[model samples]
Target: MRKLIGCGLVVALAGMLACGVGTEDGPGLQLAFARQPLDAPCPELPGEPGSAPVLDAVELTLLRADGTVHFRKRVSPGSDGKVRVGGIAAGEDLTLEVRGLVSGQVAWYGSAAPVNIRQGVDTTVGIFLAAVGDVSCAARPLQAPRAFLAAAGLPGGRVLLAGGVDRLQADGCGPGCDAWQATAAVDMYDPATGIIYPVARLHTPRALASATLMPDGRVLVVGGVRQLGLQAGSGMFLQVAPGDVLASFEVYLPGPDVWIEKTMPQGMVLHSASLLPDGRVLLAGGGTAPDEEHASNFAYLYDPGLGSAGEVVKVTSAMATRRLGHAAVVTAAGKVLLIGGAIYPTAPPLEEFTPSAEGGVFLEKLSSGLPANLMFAGAAIIPLRPDEVFVAGGRVYDGQVLQPPVTGNSRLIRRISSDDAEWQEGPALASPRWLAGMVTAGRELVLAGGFGDEQLTPSREIEVFDPQGELAAAGQTSVERAGHAAVPLVGGQVLLAGGLGPQDVLRSAELFTPAALAGESEQ
Candidate 1:
């Protein structure tokens, strides 16, 4: 086990719930959870004052490292919703999954993997078991309204929100807006404790950048603009300008919470950064000039295993084409699949990239059954199984409008390996969306607001796409949100932070909990 969760009884103090309920004998574990309300002062310094989480019991499951079930039981928690279990086998690497229950349904879930037990020692495991499928507000919003910011989940259930525009300045925003400025400000949110802390600022201001959590636990950031807000030309089109893009990348060290910046040979924006199986980050396919007007076929690899001393390696061969607003994912075969994107006005074909054994050539055009001319740039891809994923929603080319129409179509790609792959049809979305906020909650794919059919307006409809079932309406938010940061709290609960709302940059926030659907197992 790398680290053990600190076990303790989180006693209620001024509405704050404790982690575990009690202690047990002979290599025991004390487990507890924290929950959020529909409306809470999450960032209020003195204390997290809000309504209580509704949990009646906790279902506990203990397993060996090899997937063998060691112990399983459902016990009623104390007033704080905690339970303690003892008599676990000592010296065994184990896994623990805890579920919070309300009215006998699975509402919340969390787990600690590869845990070890020592004789007569107690393990304290604290988890955040947030309510599922509920929309609530988080208090003390981002110091200011932000749009196009990047957020990533930190170790220990915290979230890091970095670099975005604080406001749409006089330069104007989309539609009638001209330009917006980016902020270097950064913050961290701890869902377990319900607190947001002001952290170290970025060395350079950025927006629409890529942030990836490295294997060593530090966050690696790259590619974004500082002062250039995407301008809507002719009052309907939007794209990032080139000169304002940042060429450097930064790393967020956990303990000090400080960002260490490093320079890259070339600058890129609207690119896809994929963390490889070997602890390296492969950046592929983005616009390099004229708001991506001149797309470049460039690729860079960064090995972050060396901590702050890591380096970014440039690739020898260029990509299949210049692609902007693209999406990439590490495939089951370990190849980097650079999916649908636009080479300016043209949507390029799906290209598979292999850095390890491709003879210095990374990009190889692969075939998918998706519409030949469909340009689903910046589409949402959700993992269904280890070898399967579903790609959804992006702007498609249409001659009628300056900007192509937003799509509600989703194509399922089953990639067992490099040679074996196929694209399956619909499970189409109820509403068409581009740049939508998406989250994979166990088997459920929750797609929140984004740019909808009306161009500048945001989509308030929230839909749940289940591959095992059907696409259904979960709920809707009062505010129209898109280009926002969606951070995962304890047990896959999502915290939606600031983003653009029609004509204004918003400071408002929402806490979303997925529905604990029946028959869903531990995530």
Candidate 2:
């Protein structure tokens, strides 16, 4: 498989961009786009392989803060590229959109957000344009290969990735193999430039933890182990000592780019963390305290804004059942739903959380018409609509020993009203994917990057959850990936960053441009 190249404008040196030609000049700002070798097969430019496109143009559109178009121009580009765009009113909240055109069709996209333009001043910003509906390699590789890392969306169109193990245990270590002394290494991925920047390391290194984006833009990472290992072949646990089982969590501040550790009465692993509408983080169901590797029904609400000390209050009522690897998501109506999850492949009734001024209540929803023993333990539960979530590929064991039970089956969970919700059957994927990265692109869900085999072999196909409850083939990520971080970027592109391949943890990243973002150009 070929690694799709990441093509975009890089803001290095703040000088000449040869691909795009600017039209007019006034009191606006000056910008340039850096170019990369066009490696992908373009039907329009069949003759140009390594040569730059001098005849191709870029459609530039300036947008007001209210999302209204302020200016639109398609400049006939020249080989010596540098565009000087201007002619805008002062104090206008402006944004610039650039679409690289090949044979009069939009092929690449990038954008810049800003606070208007002024005469004799240069506003420097970076923009990244990725090919639509394709997965390509990042311009740069990750610092190292890592798995079980925590990724949270940060301010300024950046993603914070922290605390993951860099090694892969090829020898059989069984259950204890999942936990290892994690690396404190931290990094930031910028969609604007398609670059991964190494940042401040975590004060308390942890793996298998959940990173939540706080309302204030800070990151609150909870649970997971500080150090754990096992003997190869013997399957004996080791490195279990003081601080090995983390009894604390870390908060990462973006401006300072530092990690601060906070003490907790007990730590947890395999926990489900969800941010509520009121700025409180709802942490539910994981192995906690001395035993941080088992399932517990306890839940808590972590308030990051309360005092400087902050506060972690336990929910009075516990979950209906013990869920180790359960999936949890906050509905559009601000309700929390705990879906099927267990240590193994087992299906459980969905649980909903309703908060009052006094406390939050957890009620188990009856599996009235669900498949008998429907398993979504390793599946992805993502937002489909307001108060609705759709479940995608996961480990669905159906007792067929001859055939692997990993399934492509999917279902939609719709919160019909405040008091009731229904499970609607969704279309099955062409390929079965376990632990797939499912993210919403506009109204559609892009299911990409997962292991399709029982041996944890990665997959490369990209599927879409169409709005009409139908499944359609969108495109491919080209690179095999499992357990990677799939995140939506500023523009309409999805970033699939690092995951485990066949034998080792991967350091390669891929960028996916959604079909909806390209409009009619895809057809």
Candidate 3:
């Protein structure tokens, strides 16, 4: 009987060891996670006067039943909206404490509610901030001729930024039009320092113009109005030059400071221009006729290598509906996907443009059952996965001329070309806005500055959406803005160019990193 008891005890001990129970009876918590963004900072909304305190540093601790710590970590805000904590135990209760948070200047911070963990569970903690009075300089005024360094480039080659509006209004930048003027200055930003230096000035005044980075390394500056007024109808209209939409285009080469004029096969305005993988340039649909030309189905293809001798070829008129103020992006499949923009008054509007084998073909490719509500200035299209296109955050078409601008929780992320042939809502932004800049960086979708009709105010807030279509990370920009340009650079960073603010055209720019999305997970 004693021998049988001994054998049973040995078997039980073996079973416990296999189950990861140490003989010493130490804590059973095990830590594991995918990646951690240690340097990325999460942005906090600016505190109001005497409002509350803001937390600067967050510390996370894993504890046992006896209050003994298994692990601990410290985190801070990164340029991108991420605060990652990697290597968390697979199953352990965690307590988070926020310290060094600045409430005005006083280091007033708080702790978060305790979090319970389960095996293979991923979790997050929220830390609230208190506000105090702020005395530092507000966000700098964003101006024209804005430039950012390009990380990806050919060897021995340099990137340059030219032909944006100049700072004509210096009424102390930050929400509210003080002064506005056209810009003619050209500059270049060094990737090493993130600083822009004066290069040479251009003789042209181009505002709201489209600039394409050509394969030959020169920038192709296309049609933009050179005007001096705030009203939509009053400025000198460049689109109607010489009694027709301006057919004139120019290219700026760096060897020497020069702007060489080139003739467009067709004069057009507000069109979408992109560089094909073959080094050819495709200029598609815009207000092509003359003054106030709405949407045109016409498209033109330009080959720079063919030089002045080559004729600009006209592609087929294939759009089901005319469109403008829309976004056109080159998909990973080498096809151009034109997302939500204003459609003409014609029936069955809203279409997509894809390059056909013959030339270019614009066809209606969205699901009929999907929401066809008119989404104008607010729509942004980005790729979620290689085979999937994600469309999110835009105003719905009210079927009337946009007056007083559209507003609110209209947050919806639709998935295209997935297993489902339709759009499924993902997540919404903190606020509803129009004309905000959208781009994907580090497998995350970022929504930046835009205008909200309710406040009629521009926001510098920036938010990051996860790859899994989950909650958005907390972060914001130094300025609120929209109508600005957000382009992806090679090194996985984005260059936010000129956009209109409430008061003035933004002359300033900011860089965003993806550090705030950092986290730990259980295996």
Candidate 4:
């Protein structure tokens, strides 16, 4: 393989000592390459040699942006005898050319798939240099997790992760037991460095509840259980245990890093909440009581400007059925779009709420076209346009288990458009882990670690989906644990913070880079 240097105008091939292509022992290697992003140009261009016989002397050439040969040279393969390109500067997108002579014949020779060289330390493009007959391509690997997380943010900023569950149900125990630790701590990460700093600790515990970041930058942490058990002394060994599925919520101001306890509609677990465009928080459909086997469709709106300021006002009746572990998102039209949660009956109905206090009317009920499973863990919503809500992975709606299984069926990102609507299946995830956290950055959907079955085996894998006309793999993340939180930063990257791992709970975080958009051309 030859490396291209300079502004795509110059190339130098590392010398090979063998005369003919290598023996037929190994298949010829295929070459591939990717241009550097606009902001970060690679200092060098890396090319690949497809599965082919070993060759002797190879020459690399470059076509300058000015249509002139910038430089050409013969390079001795430093270690592997493969040609190397280096010393590229910023602002240069170079087209590389490679040529190799084998068996007294000029065999491997070809140009690259275009390199986007930017101003950066590591800009890699894999170009294959191979003879036609002996060359073959390599298999593609799974997308990286960090690349997915970084693309979840817009150009302006990233998302903010307040605080979430640190451990799965089986923490510090022998095995097969699930529990949640009620801590008042909340943290946010700096997207640039993936560093997490304590934002504030709540006066009380808010675990496994819903959390939303308001437009004003303040975070709202709502209803979660502080204590464990069923019916306050049923003595039943439920996996989760008897706990306070809190009905009350609190506000955490990022600037002040303070927690303000506020009134709530009613205590519930695994409920859904969204911030309406009007600035009021609309919470709906968790469990009315932790001990109850079923959920109440009862919905409420907390008027932050209302009596006592931000009081939870129960206004509506219940939905067609009760739901927990369902998904909800506020549409661009200011309607609360809810869908795909498990009810007590363990059936499927994706519904939405228009937030009417009078008769408790929702836009419509959606139940028809779901992917045969629903989970209550946590779900991320991506708005395709303004009106469409795309619900990604979550727990399968199971009424039998006290805690819905930590696993999720490989369901496509479900879509809920209007109230009187049917659930539509969108692109499915690369993997099917549940309790995973998701956030959006521009055209990419970022998914972070979550549990597979038990929360202890926290998956650190990060998957990003590019929603540009077609959904595709953007990149992968470095972490492998689950039950963590991911938020977009003010910059282009996203910050991922604490979650559960197999050995112990995590307090660390990482950053994701969405280089796909940054590297590709606009048109």
Candidate 5:
């Protein structure tokens, strides 16, 4: 009996030894980092000594599926200019983020594709870092201090910018004291040359307007605030007096470089305009009066084929709710989905507008609303798929002091049928954002700079959201911005232009070439 007991004890000791050995031999990930040869010139600060940026440091972070940081390490490159990070656990899928810094500034930043660790083996991975794309200043617009300006991409890779405040005086007023008058100045941006040339100005000066590209290649510029006479003692430009919303509309012809004045039934501001499948523009829900406090429930349809005079038609049925700063998108089935707006108390319900048999429009309210109360969120339809739409980064008022809370609850909603739709919680953005520029490039959704709750400051971080995967950090702009314009270029790249930047209104613009295409160009 003593020998038997000793044998059991020996076996137990052996089992424990085996477990210890297994842990020591557990799988790990081996990462090797090398800087990719850049085809473009490295970025340099003006009057700086260095001709090209040099790598100073690299930050490595391993994130779990939920975007929580699991392990973080900072390392410098070896003599061979390579970094190796090991000891990652096996069998767990992880996202690897590598940020390269030059003189403490982010020079190159990217994420490695998700990696799967294998037990008992060292998984080897190679990461190549490239220089951040070159950002050269484009020609400034003819008019200075352009704010709340409208821009639309033309068919031939050109962008039309129009109607914003141009400072007229600069005394003891303030930052924008000089610019009190909205200008009708129009400018055309040529991407090939990185220059903007003045074009014909609009008949009426407007600001905070909506510009939509028409089916015939003309651009339709709709309602905005036309400034009344500036108050004598006031240092700032008064956008409008009471009941001073401009009902005038205009169509810009690229061929002639001209703006033809048109008229709308009602003056609107902060309204959303979407192009329908039938080649008509759906203008809906804006502030009827100049003040944002008074929102309109009215909707209008502008028929471009009918020519300039009396082309806008008012929809007989009014919207279920008055919306200001709302978003609208046309679905795959030719229905319009009107999303969250400035309405308060409870989250605004999702409403769909369907075309009726009698050449009218029908409005139906959907039971499934937004995940939360959202306003000024950047929204866009996922490319190639009409049924699914992506909405991200908006402000939600929680009945307290105004805070820019990053809900981290953005989502993707699909229209299963005319009335049936489903919502799935999407990957959270890297940071909370509102009033950002959203556009689709290839299969990825690109969200650019926006205002965040962190100090109420604008974010320069650009996050790319893959519908099938997680949000990956992407290239950033030269300046922090919100209320900017992001227009997808002919290629997969995006043209991002003017908006409110860190200090004041900006006329700067940059081109965001997708990393894949950017890689190809380097090769």
Candidate 6:
């Protein structure tokens, strides 16, 4: 393969030739190139390639018998989806190499059959462009058994999975034998290489933490439980002592591969963080302790560029309600929407936070709330639009029930804007889910692996919702999970990692690739 530099096609002709038809002295060879049809299957390659990548440009190089470059030309496809290259020596055995560029990156490449260019004849080559990248699920995780971990998308199409429980000997620890312990292990997964390797470990072990990718490419990991305890009951081990909440947070700098620890105003768990428009992060409502009785009203602001060493500033503007297991998202209008969670009876189910002058912020309860007291619902920002969010299935609290009643089917809501905001109910989920993971994949919202049904069981089913269309079944994970981390990756893929599985915590992971969209033709 020949590598060429510069943005445009670099043309190098050994000698000047007339643009007219072939002559005895200098015969001109014309070559025409066209892409395969969109419905055509991608050609198999050694590595996975993107499916039906739109070819932005093409480069062709002619080589002599001895493998020396004789001529080269880069040309953009014409209206007919073909590129024509002329002025070549005829009646000679020449090797033709072609490369297809998608967004300036070499995505497809192939060599034409050795050709003996005959005088006064045009040669046509049909190049089939194959797709790149993996479109299949990953079989396992990089680390051991883990649950309630966090994942963030990095700049270079890599994913960072960090801090969760790593199960130890299941039966040796007595009644709590099945109980898993938290881990500080961190792993970096490169989709290009299909490798998940260890990075830096957190200063403290954490599970159920929130990892938000900042605009600067660093990840802010905040608030989770540190330890979990269980007791034997009714011939089965049950969680008797919940883990302690963690006030300390950490920052992971991908460039330096380092972890920096910082402290929040108070310990918290089951919280969520949103990346603000100004590059700072809003760490919102979570329980001050592990139990719902200790749910907190406190929220914090983390400025990555503030203080000589940076710091997490506690926001003095307390939320009207205490929230734990809530979901938060930054709207396009530069406002933060705090959604369903455990709140005091008097507290509203929905609220919005607006940043003010002098580095302060304020929260106002949205006039509209969930149809019911929903918590742990999956939330995501729809693509190609700002200030629009889609929130779905969550557990509904019934005062008399010790365990919140999980719904088998739940309503979905769309928030159009913060100013004069109205929560409009959309379609219902295909199945009821809570603690599910949601991410925007292209223009669609993908919900994966959450607790569902009245029994609050883990699920492996994946559902995709098209804003302009209806909710449709997509794919499934290898294992049923709840509280897992799902992150949208480049190239329209989603990475889902550790969460609580049917029988215990899960260390397994999977990747989901939605089917190709219509009108996606190869260039």
Maximum-TM-score candidate: 2
TM per candidate comes to: 0.81, 0.83, 0.60, 0.60, 0.67, 0.69
Candidate 4: minimum summed lDDT over ten consecutive residues — where? 142-151
- Per-residue CA lDDT of candidate 3, range 1-523, in tens? 1110000000000122334433422222221111111111211122122212123544445555455665565655434323444444444444433333333222322222244554334343333221111101111222243321111222122335555444554432223323344566655533222334566665555555566776666677665544322223111111233233446666776667567766666665567677677766677766622223455767777667666423357887655656555556565556665555445433343455556545767666554434434343433344355545455455443344433333333334344443233544545557666556667754666767766653446666666656565546346654555656665433234545545555655565445544422223211
- By the lDDT metric, which is better: model 3 or model 6? 6
How far does residue 301 in candidate 5 sit from its true spot (Å)? 0.5
lDDT of 6 by residue, 90-175 (tens): 63666555566677766544343345565454444332222222123332245666777888988656789998877655654464
Point out where model 5 deviates above 4 Å.
1-143, 168-180, 227-242, 288-293, 308-310, 356-359, 397-403, 407-409, 416-418, 454-456, 519-523
Q: Residue pairs in steric clash, candidate 6?
A: 48-133, 49-131, 49-132, 49-133, 50-131, 50-132, 50-133, 55-523, 332-387, 408-432
Q: Which stretches of candidate 2 lie over 4 Å from their true place?
A: 1-6, 10-31, 35-55, 62-67, 90-95, 112-121, 172-180, 227-245, 288-293, 342-348, 357-359, 371-384, 397-405, 416-418, 520-523
| Best of the candidates, lDDT | 1
Task: Compute the lDDT for candidate 2.
Answer: 0.63
Model 6, total clashes: 10
Clashes of 5: 4
lDDT of 1 by residue, 393-427 (tens): 76644322334344445677666354646777756
Superposition TM-score, candidate 4 onto the true structure: 0.60
lDDT of each candidate versus the true structure: 0.64, 0.63, 0.46, 0.47, 0.61, 0.62
RMSD for each of the candidates: 6.3, 5.8, 16.0, 13.8, 17.2, 12.1
The sequence of per-residue lDDT tens digits that candidate 5 reaches over residues 428-453 is 88878777788776577788887665
Number of colliding residue pairs in model 3? 38
Q: Assess candidate 6 and give its TM-score to the true structure.
A: 0.69
* Candidate 4: regions farther than 4 A off: 1-175, 178-180, 191-194, 227-238, 241-243, 288-294, 307-309, 344-348, 356-360, 363-373, 377-384, 398-420, 424-428, 454-456, 468-475, 520-523
Better of 1 and 3 by lDDT: 1
Put down candidate 4 lDDT per residue, 1-523, tens digits, no spaces: 3332211111322211121343322112222222111111111112332233455555555556654654454443334544454443333445555555455445444444234444322343333232221211111111111111111222223234443444345433334444555565554433221123445566776556666766666566777766332121112222343345665777765555577887565676667777777787777776633235546677877676764436777855556566666677666566765665645445445555665434246644544555444643444455355444455556544455434332234334333454345455556655556657667754566666665543335564556655442444544434355645566543124555555444545544444545432221111
Ten consecutive residues with minimal summed lDDT in candidate 6?
Answer: 3-12
